[model samples]
Target chain A: MNKIQDIQQFLQDENLDAALITTPDNVFYVSGFKSEPHERLLGVMVFKEAEPFVICPLMEVPDLKASGWNFEAVGHQDTEDAWEVLAAAARKRNVSLEKIAIEKSHLTVERMERMEELFEGVTISRIDEKLNSLRNIKSEDELIKLRKAAELADYAIEVGCKEIAEGKTELEILMAIEFEMKGKGAEKMSFDTMVLSGPKTASPHGKPGSRKIQKGDFILFDLGVVYEGYCSDITRTVAFGEPSEKQREIYETVRKAEQAAIDLVRPGVKARELDKVARDVITEAGYGEYFTHRLGHGLGISVHEFPSITGTNDLELQEGMVFTIEPGIYNPEITGVRIEDDVVVTADGVEVLTKFPKELKIIEA
Target chain B: MNKIQDIQQFLQDENLDAALITTPDNVFYVSGFKSEPHERLLGVMVFKEAEPFVICPLMEVPDLKASGWNFEAVGHQDTEDAWEVLAAAARKRNVSLEKIAIEKSHLTVERMERMEELFEGVTISRIDEKLNSLRNIKSEDELIKLRKAAELADYAIEVGCKEIAEGKTELEILMAIEFEMKGKGAEKMSFDTMVLSGPKTASPHGKPGSRKIQKGDFILFDLGVVYEGYCSDITRTVAFGEPSEKQREIYETVRKAEQAAIDLVRPGVKARELDKVARDVITEAGYGEYFTHRLGHGLGISVHEFPSITGTNDLELQEGMVFTIEPGIYNPEITGVRIEDDVVVTADGVEVLTKFPKELKIIEA
Candidate 1:
C-alpha cells in the first residue's frame, strides 16, 4: 500500500477520527509535497473515512500539486488566517474532526493551542510514536535512494581525504569537499559538513574553522549528502602525517569498535546490545571515558531520526532497518577518532551501504 | 542592560517566577551560546529572583562556557534524562517554579507536557510575544555583524552574476556562488540559495535544479549569508541577454515597487503602510495579483525574524529595526522579477545594508 493509505489504516486501527500531520518531514511522507515553510503553516490533514488534504501557503499550492499530490489543497495568502483555511477545509471534508491525532513531538504549543481553538472540545492524541514506527521500516524505493546517497557520502569523504595537506585550513578542506559534492549533483548536505583538525576534533560536534592542518595531526571529516530526499551520513578520521603511538592506538580502537558494532547488526539484536558491543571494545582499550556519545542514530529522511542506538534503548533490530554505526574515542590532550558507516539490516546479516575504508590512512603532508 | 537582564526584568514585570527559553536563536540571544541540539534538550532557565542557568547536552558544556556563558550549565548524557537534570538545576537555584513563562511558539507539545509533569501543576504562561519584542530591535553590535553579513551577501550576488551565462544550469550557478562565498569566509547561507531561471522563477520559492539558462530568460538570485551570528538576505533578478518588452516591464515594475517600499522605511511609519507603498506600485502596474507574497520580513540573527511586513500588520517601524523590502511580479508563462534590499530603520530614515545595485543588468551571453 502507499504511504497515505498506510496512514489511513493506522488511523482506523487506532480509532482516531483523523490525523493532523505537521512537520515538513511528516507532511512530505503523507503527501508527496515537501516544503520548508519557515514560520508559515504547512500541514496535511488525513482522515480515516474522508480524503486527505494539504493546507499551506498559497504560493506553495501549485508546487504542491506539481509534486504529484492529487488531494485537495487549501491555500492561504499572507493576509488570510491559515487556521481559518485549515478549519474550512476540515469542515468541507465532512469527516469527524473529534479525537484528532497530532504529531505532538513536532507541533508547537502555540500551533496546538490554535488548533484547539479551531476545533473546540476536540480530544487531541499523540501519534508521534506511531509515526516513528511507520517511518522506521524502509521500502525498496527508499533503500535505492538511500544507497545512492550513501555512495555520494563515500565519494565526499574520498574527495576530502585527497584535499588534505599541511597548512590547509579545515574550512578550506570542507569547502573543497562540499564544492565537489555539489558538482556531483548533491542536493545539499544532510547536516553541516564538519572537518575539524588536531585538538579541535576532540569536540564531537566541533565546527570547521580556520585552524590549519599540521604534520601528525588527525583530521576528522564527518559529513553527509541528500539525494532524492533520503540522507546519508559518514565519518572518517585520518592522520595528516605519521602519527604517534597514542594517535594510532586511538584510531585503531575506534575502528575495531565500529566494525564490531556493524558485525552485530542483524535482525532480532537489541539496539542496546549493539551499543554495548562498541562500548566494550573502546573500554577494553582504556578509552571508555573518552567514548562519550551514543553508538549511532537511525538515518533516513533526516540525519537523526527514530530509534537511537544508545545504551538504554531496547529496540530490537529488524530487517529493512537502516541506521549508522559510528564509534569514537576523543581525548583533548591526545586525539579524537571516529569511524562511521551507514548500514541496512538484512534478514540474517547487514548490508553496509557506505564503502569508505575505516583503516587509519596516514597522508604524507 | 544585557539580554538576560532584559528577560529577567520581563519575568519580574509579568509576575512570572521564571522563564524557560528553548529555541536555539533565543538561547543564543540570551546566553551567547548557540547550538543545534537536533531533538536533544537545550534550554536556559532564567529566574526573576535567582541566577539563570543552562541545561544542554554534556558534549556542549565546554563550548557553552567558551561562548562566555558563565552560568552554571547542567549537562546530561544520552543515557540520562535531561528533564531530571533541569529539575535539579532549578532546585539548586531555590527559585519558585510555580509560575514560569515559556516560548510557546517554539516549545513543542511533547516538551511542554514533559515540563508540566516535571513541575507538577506549574502555571505555564506564553512569553513568545515578549521574546519577539525583545529580539525585534537590533543592537549596535548586532547591526555591525548584520552590515558585514549584508556585504557578504551583496558580494555573493556579484559573484553569481559573473558566473551566469547562456547554457549554464541554475544548479551550477548556485554552486559557483556558494563556493565563492565559502572561500570568502561566509559561515553559512541564511537560507537555501535560490537561482531560478525563466519559468522556474515564477515560483517564488523555487529550488535551483539542472535547468540551463536561455537567452531572454530572467534569472532570479535570492541568497543570503551568515557572518558573526547575524544574517543578511538579498534578492535580485538579472537578464541573461536582451530581454523582451514584457520581461523588461515586469522587471521595472518590481524595481519601482522595491524602491518605493525602501523609501518608506523610516521611524514612525506603519509596516502596513510600507507594504501598501510597494503594493500600490505593483497594483498600478497591473501586476497586483501576480505579486503573491508579503513585501518582506524582519532580518537579523535569523533571516526571517519578527514583525513581518504585510498589508495587515499595523506595527509602526522603529529605529534599530532591521528588515527587508522585496517586491516581485511573477508570471509563469513569461518571466519573474524581484528586487530586494536589507534595510535598517535609523532615527531619521533608513540605512540600506545590502549595497548590490537593484537596476536590471543585461549580461552578455
Candidate 2:
C-alpha cells in the first residue's frame, strides 16, 4: 500500500497514467521483488487515482503472496503468448492502453513492437525521465542499505591498504581486497575493483593487471561493494614511499577539491554548479584538463544512474538523494591522486557515509 | 581480411547487399575491440566485399592502433549525428542504402529509428540470425584462450574441493575458490560462483549465503573462469558424507545424461537435437519436470551466447561451436544434482573442454 501510494503521488505530479517498467531496477523500486537478471519478465505498476496493481508472470504469484498486494495475477505457460496475458490484465484493470507510458530507456524494439501489436489502439509515450526523477530521491530503507554498502567499502579498503606493498601485483591486491569484502558478506563487487599503481593510475577505469607494485609508486585503489542490491563507491590513493614534493602538493589540492565538492551538496543546490566548485579549484591549480570524467553520479540499484554531475546537466539536488563526490588529478607520465566519498543530501547539509581514511598515507614496503 | 571475406560470402549467400552490426559482441568479433557498455558509442562493422570499416567514438582510436586491423575507423561524438558518418562510409563504398541488412537482435529502438531516418531508402532487413551463425564458430585464437580458461577453472575447483568442510559457509567457499582463481591470473569470473548446499541446491542459480555446511548435504559448486575475455564453465557436486542411495542414483543419471549430450554434439547436428539427448534421458528417469531450464547455451565472449540448447531452437551445431551440456534434476524439498561441462563440436565428434572431475565425490567433513 505504501509503495502504491508513492507511485500514485509520482504519477500525479509527473502527469502520467501508467508506467510500463522493463528495467529490473525500476521494477524493484516500485515492487518489493528483486528478480535475477535472467528472469525475462516485465513488471507494470499502474496508477489511476487509486491503489496500484503489480502485473507479473503467473509463476511469481506464490513468491509475492506475502507482499499483501491486490490480486491481478496472470500466469501463462511458456508456449502461451505473453500478449494475451498482458491484454487480459489491462482489460481487468480498466486501464485505457491509449494512455500507457513506457520507459523508453529500457524498452527493447522487440518488446515495444509486441506491445504495439497486442494493444493495437494504445498510445505508448516515453516516460523514462519521469521514472529517473522518481528514483533520484532515496527513501529511508534505501539510505539504510546505502550506508551499509559504504561501510563495507570502507572496511574493504582498510584491508587493501594493509595488504598492499612492494612486489605485490595490482591483480594480487585486487583479489585480496575482494576476498576480504566477500568474507564480510558483500553480495558482489559493484564494479571491477580498480588497483592501479604509478603511471597506470592515470586512466580513470584501468583494469587491474599483473604489473608488480614497486617502491616510489603512487597506488590508487578505486573500489565499491554491492550490499543488499545497493552499491557504494570509494577511491583512495597512497604513496608507497616518502612522497615527492609534487605528489604531496597534488594530493592536498585534490583532497581540498573533493571536500569542497561534498560541502556544496545540499538540498536546492544545482548539481552542475557544485561540480564547478571543485572543477574551478583544480582548474586554478593548473590540473583542470587532467580531470576528464564527470565529478560524480547518482548511485542506487545501478552503479551509474541519472543526473550526471557534469557541466552539461542542470538538475537540482534534493534532500534524500545520495551520490559520490570523487575528484582526481591524473598525469599520464607522473602520478595520479583521487579521493572519493559517498554523500547523502540532507535538508540543510550532506551526510558523508564512507569513513575510510583518505588523507595521503605513506606506506613503507 | 579473412573475416571480411567470410562476411562478404555470407551476405552474398543471403542475397543482401550490406549488413550493419551494432552489438558489442558482434563488433568485438569483427573488430577485436571490446567496448564499454551503456555508452552512446556504437561499433558498426559493415561488409560489402571489402575491408570492414569500424564506426566508434573518437577516444578508442589510440587503443585500436595496436590491433593492426585493416578497418577504416570513423569517430563521432553525438549518436544522432553519427548517422552522417555511416552514410559517408556507405557513399565512399559506392553501395546505395537499398538491400541493406542489420543485426536486428542487438539494435536498440533509438538507433534503429535513427538508421531509418538517415537512410530512408535502405531496406534494413534483420540479419541477426546470420551474425549468430558466424559467431557460433570459434577461431584458433579463441580456442587457445578458451583452453587456458578451462585449465584455470579446473585447477581452481580442484583447490576448492580440498577446502570444503562441515563448518564452511557457501559464501566462504565461493570466495576461497575465486581467490585461488585470481592467484592463477584470471582477469575476472565468467559469472557469479554459485555454491549451494543442502536443499538450497534445488534452485539452479541460488545465491551464496551464510548457510553453513552440514553432514550429508549435497554441495553444488557451479563456477567459471574468464581469461582474456574467453569463458569456461564447469559444475561439480559433492556430498559431505556418504551420499544416500537415492542421491547416488540421481547423480549417476545426470552424469550419464550429460555424457550422452556431449556425445551427440558434432558438426551438422542440430543443437536442439543434442538437447533432446539429455532431456530424454532425464525424462525417462521420471525427473523430467525437475530439470526446469535449458540444457545449455553457447559459450564465448559472453557467458551465455547464441544457439541456445533448447528444444525450440533449430540452429545446427558447427565444427567450432563451443557450448555447455548441463543436465540437472532438482527435487523441491530433497536435493539437487547437476553435472555440466563445456563441449566443442568437432568434424567427427565432440571434445569436452571442461576437465573437472564430474563423478560424485564423497568427502568427510
Candidate 3:
C-alpha cells in the first residue's frame, strides 16, 4: 500500500477518527507539498473513513497544486479564521471530529488550545511515535535519494579540505565549499555549514567566524547537503599544518571509536550497545569526559530523526534503518576531533554511504 | 531599566510569580545567547522576587558562559531528567511557582504538558503579547545594527542585479549575491535568498530554482542579511531586458503604492491605514485581487515581528518602531513586481534605512 493508505489503515487500527499532520516534514511525506510557513497554518487532515484534504495559506494554493496534490485544498486568507474554515471542511466531509490524533511534538500550545476550543468534545492523542515508525524504514526509492545526498556531502568535504590554507578565515573556506556545492546542483545545505578552527572547534556547535587559519591548528568541518528532499550530514576534522603529538592522539582516538561503532551496526543489535561500543573505545583512551553529547542520531529526510543513538535508548537496530555514527573527543584548551559517516543497516552487515577517508590528514599550509 | 528588568516589572504588574522564556529569539534578546538547540531544551526562568537562571544542555554550558550571561546556568546531561533539575533550581531560589507566564505561541503542546506535570499547582498564562510589546520599540544600539544590516541587504541586491545574464539560472544569481554578502562580512542571510524569474515570481514565497533568465522577464529578488543580531529585509524586481507596457505599468503601480505607504509613516498614524494606503493604490489600478498578501510586517531582530502591517490591525505607528513597506502585484500568467524598503519611525517623520532605488531598472542581458 502507498503511504497515505498505510496511514489510513493506522488510524483505523488505533481507533482515531482523524489525524492532523502539521509538521512540514510529515506534511511533505504525506501530501508531497513542502513548505516552511513560518507562523502560518499548513496541515493535512486524514480521516479514517473519509478522503484526506489539505489546508494552507491562500497564497500557497497554486504551489500546492503544482506539487501534484490533487485532493481538496482549503485555502484561507490572512483575515479569515483558519480554524473555522478547517472545521467547515471537516463537517462537509461528514467526519466526526472526535478522538483526533495530532503531532503533539510539533503543535504549539496556542494551536492546541485553538483546536480544543474548535472541537469541544474531541479527545486528542499524540501520533508522533506512529508517524516516526512509518518513516523509519527506507524504501528502495528513498535509499536511492539518500545515497545521492550522501555522495554530495562527501563531495562537500572534499572541497572544504582543498580550500583549507594558511591565512584563510573559517567563513571564507565555508563560502568556497558551499559555492562548489551549489555548482554541483545541491538544493541547499542540510543545515548551516560549520567550519570551526582551533579552540573554537572545541564547541561542537560553534558558528564559523573570521578567525584565520594558523599553523598547528585543527580545523573542523560539519556540513551536509539536501538532494531530492533527502539530507546527508558528515563531520571531518583535519590539521592545517603538522599537528602536535596530543592533537594526533585525539584524532586517532576519535577515528578508532567511530570505526568501532560503525562495525557494531547490524540487524538485531541494540542502538544503546552501539553507543557504548564507541564510548568504551574513547574511555579506554582516557578521554571519556571529553566525549560529550550523544553518540549519534537517525538521519533521513530530516538531518535528525527518530531512534536516537544514546547510551540509554534500547531500540534494536533493524535492517533498512539509516543513521549516522559519529565519535568525537573535544578539549577546550587543546583540540577537538570528530569523524562521522552515514550508514544503512543491511540484512546482516551495514553499507557505508559516505566514502570520505577518516585517516588523519595534515594539510601543508 | 534593561530588558530583563522590564520583564521583572511586567511580572510584578501582572501578579505572576515567574516567567519562562523558551523561544530562541526571546532568549537571545534577554540573555544575549543565541543557540538553535534542535529538539533539546533551552530556556531562561525569570522571577519577580528572585534571581533568574538559565537551563540548557550540559554541552552548552561553556558557550552560555561565554555569551556574558552571569547567572546560575542549570546544565543537564542527556541521561538526566531536566525537569527535576529545573525544579531544584526553582527551590534554590526560594521563588514561588504558583503562577507563571510562558510564550504560548512558541511552546509546543508536548512541552506544555510536561510543564504542567512538573509544576502541579501552577497557573500558566500567555506572555507572547507582553514580550512583543517589550521588543516593539528599537533602542539606539539596535538602530545602529539595523542600519548596517539594511546597507548590506541593499548591497546584495546590487550584486544580484549585476549577475543577471541570459543563461544564468536563478540559483546561480542567488549564489553570486550570497557570496558577495559573505565576503562583505555578513554573518548569514536573514532568510533564504529568493530569485524568481518570469511567471514564477507570481508566487511571492517561491523557491529559487534552475530557471534561466530570458528577455522581457521580470526577476524578483527578496533577500536580507543578519548583522550583529539585527535583521534587514528588502525586495526589488528588476527587468532582464526592455519590458512590455503591461510589465512597466505593474511595476510603476507597485512603486507608487510603496512610496505612498512610506510617506504615511509618522507617529500617530494607524498601521492599518498604511496598509490601506498601499492597497488603495493597487486597487485603483484594477489589480486589487493580484495583491494577495499583507502590505508588509514589522522588522528588527527577527525579519517578521509584531505589529503586522495588515488592513485588519489597528496598532498605531510610534516613534522608535521599525518596519517594512512593501507592495506587490502578481498576475500568474503575465508577471509580478514588488518594491520594498526598511524604515524606522523618527521623532517627527521616518528614516528609510534601505537606500536601493525603487525605479524600474532594465538590465541589458
Candidate 4:
C-alpha cells in the first residue's frame, strides 16, 4: 500500500505527469472517500510527485473534513458549472497544459468539453489503465471490509432461505431477506435483492414479482449486502418441494461446474481461462447453449468493476483480486439453476469469501 | 397523437437534417419501446421527413419486435460491439449528419465522441429544448399510465402510514412500503424508497437507517411507485404519538407551503414564481434558511426531469406538464417536515394526481 507520496512515485514511474481520478472506485482507491448514492458530484484527485488535491461540490466539504484524508479540498456550488473552480485549482497548482492524464473510461464527452474550456491548450490522454493496475490488488483494509460484507450476505441468505415457504409471494421473500440484512446493521444493499422463483428464475436478472411460492418450483435467490462501501454477492438455487428428474440432473451439472470454476481461482491464472474451466464443464454436459451471460465479474467499490471472468476476457488473475464465479443454465419456460460464490485470489490458491453452502438445498414446507 | 410523419415534419421545420434521440424517455416517447435495466445498448431513432428508423442491439430485437412499431430494426450479435452497428445504420440511411441536433443534456461525452466517429464530419448541437418540449406535453396514453402509477403510490403510502408506530426501524418501514407496491403488481420501484425518520429527516435526500421510530418524533416517508414506465412520487410526514409544539409548528408551516405551491401550478405561470409561492410561506414562517434543496422537480419518465421548480428556474409552466410541488423544512438534530404530491397543469388550472390525505396523522403504538 502506498502513501499519498508513494502514489505520486507510482504515477512518475507510469510516465503520467498528473492522473485525474473521476470514477468513485478510483477516487476511493486513491483518496479513501466514498460518496453517497445517486450523488452527481465528482471527486478529482490530481497527483503530483508527493501531493494530491481533491475537487468536489461545496456541499460535501463537511464530509471530506470528517474523512481525515490529507488533500487540498476545492468545492463548487453546482456541478452543472463547476469547471471554473476545477480549472482555477489546476492553475493554482501550476499544472502545465501538456502531459495531463485523465480517466478515459470515466470521463464523458461533456465533461471533457468542459475541461477543454477550462484547461485550454492542454493535452489529455488515458490514465485509466495505470489506475486499474494499481486497484487490481486489494489492500488489507479492503479485504477486511470485503470479508465482513460476505459474512453479512451469508447471514441474510440464511434467514431468507428460512422465510421461503409455500404461499409466500416473491415480493414478501425479498422484503424478509432485506429486512434480515438491515437487522444485521447493513447500510444498504449492494444491488437489488433478487428473489426470482418458479418460471421467473429463467431470466437471470429478473426483478422480483408478486408470484406466489408454489410446490415443486425451481427457486433462484441472488442477493448481496453492502457494508462500509464494499460489496458481496452470492446466489443459491433450491427446490421448494419434490424436484423433477430434469431439475435434479441440471442441479448436479451446475454444482459440478461451479466447483470447477471455484477450484481454478488462483494467482497467475487468466480470468478468462478460469471461466472456461466452468464453461467447459457445462458445455461437456450439453447445457452450454442454455448458459447465457458471463460467468462472473469483478466486485469492488461499485459491485461490478474490472478483471471480468468471461470466456472472452483475457486479463490474468492476480493476488487480491476478488470476483464471483456464477454459472447458470436458463431454460426459459421450464426452470433454471445457478450457483455463485465470491472468491478472492490468494498468494498460493484462492479463498472463498462467501461461506454459505453451495450444494443444492431442498426445502419442503 | 401525432405519427412518425408529424415528427419528420417537426424535424424539417426545425431545420435539422437528422435528429438523434438517445435519452430513454425520448426513445420511448418516439418508438414506444421501454429500455430494460442493465442494458448497455442505446436507441438512436433517426427522423427524415415523415419516416423513422431505430438502431438497437441484437439482444433487444425480440422485445422491440413485440413492441409492434413499424421501423427498420438492426440486430447485432451479443459479442459484437454496439457502436459499429449504429454506424452501419447511419450509413445505410445516408443521413447527412452535419449540423445534427442531439440531446446534449443526457448524452455522455464518451457516447457523443462515438457518435462523432460514426458521422466523421458533422456538427452536433444541443436539441434539449425541443425534445423537452415534446416530452412535457402528455398524451392520453401517457396520462392513463401516469394515473395508474399515482394510484399505486397512494395505496402504498396509505399502508405505510397505517404501519408506522413506535419500535419499528426506518428500513423496516421502507421495505414494507416497497413490498406492498410489488404485491400490487409494480414492475419496479421508481427510485429507492426513502424512509427518513426523526432528526435524520432533516436531510432532504437522507438514506434510510436502522434508527428505531421513537415517541414524539416526526417521521418523513418519501417514496415512489413505478408502473410500466411512468413513475409517481409522494411524501408524507407524520408524528409518532402526539406532536411537540415545535413539531406541530414546522409541520403546519410546510403543509401551508406545499398547498400554496400546488395552487400556483397552472398554464402560463412561471415555474420560478410557483417555487416562490412555497418559498414565501416557509420564509414568512422563519424557516427559509432551513429549507434546503429545490422546491420541486418535474415527475414523469424520470423522477427529477426538466422544468425544475426552483427560485432560479426560468421556464414557464404549460398545459399537460406534470411535476411535484414539495416544500420542506429541515432542522438538523430536531426534526423535518415535507409534503409532496404529483400535479398536472391543465388548460384551466391544475389537477392533483395523488389523492392521499395530507392532514397530519398521529400514530399511537
Best by DockQ: 3
lDDT of 4 at B265: 78
For each candidate, report its DockQ versus the true two-chain complex: 0.56, 0.38, 0.59, 0.52
lDDT per residue, candidate 1, A1-365, as tens digits? 29888888888899988988988988877787888897789999888999888999997899898998988988998778999989999988787888899988889999899989999999899888887987898988889999999999999999999999889888778888987888888889999999999999898978888788999899999999999788999999999889999999999999999989998989999999999999999999999999988998999988899778999899999998999999999899999889999999999999999998877888998
Write the candidate numbers in order of decreasing DockQ: 3, 1, 4, 2
Each model's lDDT: 0.90, 0.80, 0.90, 0.79
**Candidate 4 ranges with C-alpha deviation above 4 Å:** A1-17, A36-39, A332-334, B1-15, B37-39, B49-51, B332-334
Per-residue lDDT of candidate 4, residues A202-257 (tens digit): 88868887788999888888888888888999998988998888888888989999
Tens digits of per-residue lDDT, candidate 3, A1-365, equal: 27778888889899999999999999988888888887888999999988888899987899899998988998997779998999889889877788899998999889988988988888999988988997888888889989999999999999999998889999889888987898788888998999999999898778888899999899999999998888999999999889999999999999999999999999999999999999999999999999987888888889999778999898999989999988899998789889899999999989999998888988997
Q: Per-residue lDDT of B6-122 in model 2, one digit per residue for the tens?
A: 777878887777778777777777777777646565665566665567877767766665566556887776424677877777777766556777765556566667677777766
- Measured against the true chain A, the candidates' chain A TM-scores are 0.97, 0.92, 0.96, 0.93
Candidate 2 lDDT tens digits, A1-365: 45556666666676766666667787777776666546355575575553355555666666655554454545555656766776676666665556667776566667677777887866777767767887888889899999999999999888888988789888778878987787787988998889999898888877778789888899998889998889999999989988888888889889999989988888889988878999988999999988877788888888888657876678888898888888899988668888989898999999999998777899986
Model 3 — TM-score against the truth? 0.92
Clashing residue pairs in all predictions, respectively, total: 0, 1, 0, 4
Task: Report residue A102 deviation for candidate 1 (angstroms).
Answer: 1.5
After superposition, which runs of candidate 3 have C-alpha atoms over 4 Å from their true positions?
A: A65-71, A162-169, A197-202, A211-219, A238-249, A331-335, A359-365, B161-169, B197-203, B211-219, B239-248, B286-289, B331-335, B361-365
- Model 1: DockQ against the native? 0.56
| Of candidates 4 and 2, the better by TM-score | 4
Query: What residue pairs clash in candidate 4, if any at all?
Result: A108-B109, A109-B109, A109-B110, A110-B109
In CAPRI terms, where does candidate 4 land?
Answer: medium
